[model samples]
Target: MNTSLPPVEAAPTGPDAPPPGAAPTAPAKVPMAELFITFLIIGATSFGGGVVAYLRNALVLQKGWLDEERFLSALEISQALPGLNATNMAIIVGDRLRGVVGSVVAFLGITLPGATLVMVLGVLYASNAKNPYVNAALIGVGAAAVGMLTAVTFQIGRKQFGKWIDVAIILVTVTLINYLHVSLIWVLLTVGPVAVFIYRPSQLEPPSVPPKQETVP
Candidate 1:
């Protein structure tokens, strides 16, 4: 994983550091130009498997652009969608930042630079894939991608498995998917709402108790 992160614990300030509210505040409206540039940077540099983890750390933790609850909501929706995780993430994050415009900016930002780079690499590989050195390099890159993905799994798992019920749901879901080889749509349709009902942080809280009165002699 990339080690470059700004200090998360630093005192908050600026437009990005608004006070907490019942609903999380939207990010300051940045120009489409700026949004595109920021995501372009993320797309260009975020290598291997941990891209989503890197994105969460970068946007939510280090940048303080999103609170934890909101971030998790977006992540859940993104994972449920049938598409490339990173691309889905871009849409979610962008939509949060600036609604439809932000989503378009983020999508373009994530796709353009990386697509160009990959295209170039693909052309080169098409010519040189048979070469020992090129093949070895591709294999190394593939391994790095897997390593990054594993890191993302660990990070997301930590966030998702907040309660014992969450663990149970995860175990059950994994078993159904891996052992039974059940279709994902069915697994999600079954588990998604159940997990939402069972592990909802709101439902798990203790009810407020009234203060006790003093006893008369």
Candidate 2:
């Protein structure tokens, strides 16, 4: 007589399944406390106007929280809107990782140190405004800030500057704003459309060729 036990079925797997004998993967949720602490450290330690660079180092290089492309995308969105890029980035990234509470914590963490320092510095500057040393130091700082800004601008725009079309746009925008004294709203309304038209899909497509004429019978 046949007395063999029935065979058991193995578990099924899909794209997200781990390889056999591999450890199970965990979800990508970041702890709220860790998020706040990380941003707080970035805010406290970042010097000059290089908070963005510091943020990249911490989030991308050190923590592996955001990759380069995601960071730049976040930065573009932040700059396109009307707020500080660093704080905007904090809010965006935080919200992405953990929603509303994350946004609040990240914003507070990144801004609190700077805000507190600014208040202290403002009080000190008010009392010392009359001192010649303070005046000279402030002037030096302003000049250095201008130089740093120029350098950073060129560095960030180096790839775009390599293209003649981009350079032309830059020159035209500068001339319109600086020399022509055109309102930014008008300049954007005028130049924006023209730029879009210049690079439109139809403009880039080659002229279609007609089929050759039929041969004589």
Candidate 3:
């Protein structure tokens, strides 16, 4: 007689889990008008490059349109590609929610508010270009923007900072950019690949759903 270990069933995966060959499930269909309104709010309110913060709060916290993991995944994809992060995010999120039309609505909704405001502000600034008060106001706005950016960065990267590797990467990137005056191109080319390789699919473990508790016999 031979003894063998019992066959082990794999743990259930979350939304991304479908069988290896099966297509991943589609995103829930959202009403076009509602989607447009959501992004419009983000576009109008988010200022001084604080769009990402507004986006996180709107998409994840307020709307529940995307969970934390999915939002971060989308953010990662957006940042990796070209163009502005704000617009890139709009395209990805919109496409995920409603395909091509969703993408268009999101892009327009997020951009239109800022574009219109910029047109008006540009005209105003052109007239008041040398006004001392205007310059002071602009300086204040810049400082606020910096604070917002820093806050959002901490919020998003808080968990990742638990990893020493992540902390090291961040410090290195900052030192290179802020202290060494290395170009962004050099930083991305060098740090980007290392980060990717470290977090590559082969090395990382998938999130596992807890097994159901069994009842007493």
Best-performing candidate as measured by TM-score: 2
Model 2 misplaced stretches (Cα beyond 4 Å): 1-28, 67-69, 201-217
Which pairs clash inside model 1?
49-148, 49-149, 50-148
Tens digit of lDDT per residue, candidate 2, span 1-217?
5654222111133345444334223324556777888999998998766888988998877766777888899989998787888899999989877799889999999998989999999999999999999999999999999999898889878997998998999899999999999999999899999998998988686658786788997
Give all candidates' CA lDDT scores.
0.77, 0.83, 0.84
* lDDT against true structure, model 3: 0.84
Query: What is the TM-score of each predicted model, taking all chains together?
Result: 0.58, 0.72, 0.65
* Backbone Cα, N, C clashes tallied per candidate: 3, 0, 0
What TM-score does candidate 1 reach? Answer: 0.58
Q: Which candidate is the best by lDDT?
A: 3
TM-score of 3: 0.65
Worst lDDT run of 10 residues, candidate 1, spans: 4-13
- Stretch of 10 with least lDDT, candidate 2: 5-14
lDDT measured at residue 37 in model 2 versus the true structure, 0 to 100:
87
**lDDT score, residue 181, model 2?**
100
lDDT of 3 at 155: 82
Writing each residue's lDDT as its tens digit, candidate 3 over 100-192 gives 988999999999998998899999999999999999999999998888889878887998789898999999999999999999999999999
Better of 1 and 3 by lDDT: 3
Which portions of model 3 show Cα errors greater than 4 Å? Answer: 1-35, 46-76, 79-85, 96-101, 201-206, 211-217
